[model samples]
Target: MLGNLIRYLDSVVARDPAPRSRWEVLLYPGVWALFWHRIAHRLFNARLFFLARAVNHLSRFLTAIDIHPGATIGKNFFIDHGFTVIGETAHIGDNVTIYQCVTLGGSNPTNGVGGKRHPTLEDNVIVGSGAQIIGPVTVGKRARIGASAVVTEDVPEGATMIGVKARSTLVKAETYAKEFMPYGTPCKEPCEPVGSQRVDELEEQVAVLREQVAALVEANEQLARKAEKPGKPACKGV
Candidate 1:
């Protein structure tokens, strides 16, 4: 507890010194939070849940970080900046990287009590800054969530999700695909050219229409000739 307190103090000092230096950010609040979180998590895992919760709340008050003791995090986890709000039910996998302003919580509109209410991120997932992954969904291994994306559903393994509500632009189809798949290969099979085939059929129909038009034009000319010079009438057109 004393060690965590000292580290928390160091983090505060680092954030607001006489002259703020970017180098000082190496030991920022989130960095210290990660260190203290491990301790708090261990305490929770050891059945000292009350003490762990107390320490977690105290740390949040001191550091502006809100990592829950119930959240399982891995080693060397660097919280790039502060104000990260990790939820109690969030299950973070090993070697997962997170950035500042990331929110891993539930989107339960009911606000009702009980049940799993946080996301589960698999190993080696890299979440971009200000990303909000909500609900009890699972983000599969090595998936990359783009900055400021709103993820609500399960992301397949090694997928890269982007845009609102997080659509997968690139899917890591196989475990070996990440290391071996060639560039320019389509994520799914290439779609056949239905448009070109329709255009060809339309062209044939247009040619038939043109021929009909030409025949009608000739027949109309014959009729005009007959009308201008009826059976024994004047040869001079009217």
Candidate 2:
């Protein structure tokens, strides 16, 4: 048990350079949250729902991280800087790192059946701050979810998701797999290509629409002139 704890602390130290020693990692609210959650999860599985909730509430009060007692978490699961919530049915695999203010939110079943309402995060998934991965989505292995992104769909393996409604970036996951990226956002070259091209394209389309509108206005004016003059009174009106 001590060995497992050491390995867990060492993993956190490796991921975050801010910690000088394992003792510093112990002070982290995320670490303490996970600790209480372990006890709560055990009680929940034993059918002591009230005790489980008591432990969960206590942990939340102490750590500011709310992990549902029924949530299944694996080894080395780390929540950085706390303020994260994992739902009751959420399943998190080993080495899954979640940053601050993220949610593994669940959905109400349309058919009223109760099971697997929350998301399943595969191993080695990295979720950035303020990310909301909603419903019964499966975040595939090695996936990186960017900060403030809203994901309602299943993420493919090793995909780097960004933006609202979360689209995968053109940059390959292998590029990120080489090293751990802070916040799961690739802030460098190759990840960000030339922009302004989309703006230019929209401008071109607007110009084309303007020309077409102008031509239609001119045609209407010419027709109005013809109607007003009546062209020499059409056979001189007898």
Candidate 3:
């Protein structure tokens, strides 16, 4: 138990930037919630349903993060901010990081009295703020969910999911695991500076414009050739 506590504190210190000391981690809502969740989950597995529910409710009230006692969460789970919701049947693997307002929720509430209503997040998964992963979808290992993405289906391993419908932008999570991404979104490769990206876009636009101009010039030359033919005459302006 002490080892687990130390590991939890260590994970927080290693992953997050704010905590200066181990004592400061005690003040973190995520830490507190996870701490309580460990006890609550144990009680839940022991068939102490009411006690587990009560503990979970208390944790939610204190942290503003709701994790169902029945949900199976693996070690080194980091919830960056509060207001993150994990449903009853949700299963989360090790080294999962979930940001604020992220929901691992069920799509069909009416058919809730069944198995695996909520989604499963595999190891090393990162879910950004305001992202909704609904239904019984399995988010593959090392997958990164972008902010405000709505995912309904299974995500492939090492894929970066973005946009409203959660479009997959292929990025190996192993490449950027050590690098701290603020909103959990991976930048495009050949990662240019803001000014450089703008310049590149302008350059592309200029190239396209040059091609259009050349095509127009060729069309004008063709018309000139037709007009200069022996039997053909140029049309008079209206």
Report the lDDT tens digits of candidate 2 across residue range 104-126. 99998999998888999999899
Q: Give the TM-score ranking, best first.
A: 2, 3, 1
Q: How well does candidate 2 score on lDDT at residue 218?
A: 100
TM-score of 1: 0.58
**TM-score winner between candidates 1 and 3:** 3
Instruction: Pick the TM-score winner.
Output: 2
CA deviation > 4 Å runs, candidate 1: 1-26, 109-113, 171-238
Colliding residue pairs in candidate 3: none
Clash tally, candidates in order: 0, 0, 0
Model 3: residue 218 alpha-carbon error in angstroms: 54
| Pairwise lDDT winner, candidates 1 and 2 | 2
RMSD of each: 16.4, 14.4, 11.1
Residue pairs in collision within model 1:
none
For model 1, residues 167-213, the per-residue Cα lDDT tens digits are 98865635433431112232222123444666899999999999999
RMSD of 1: 16.4
> What TM-scores do the predictions have?
0.58, 0.75, 0.72
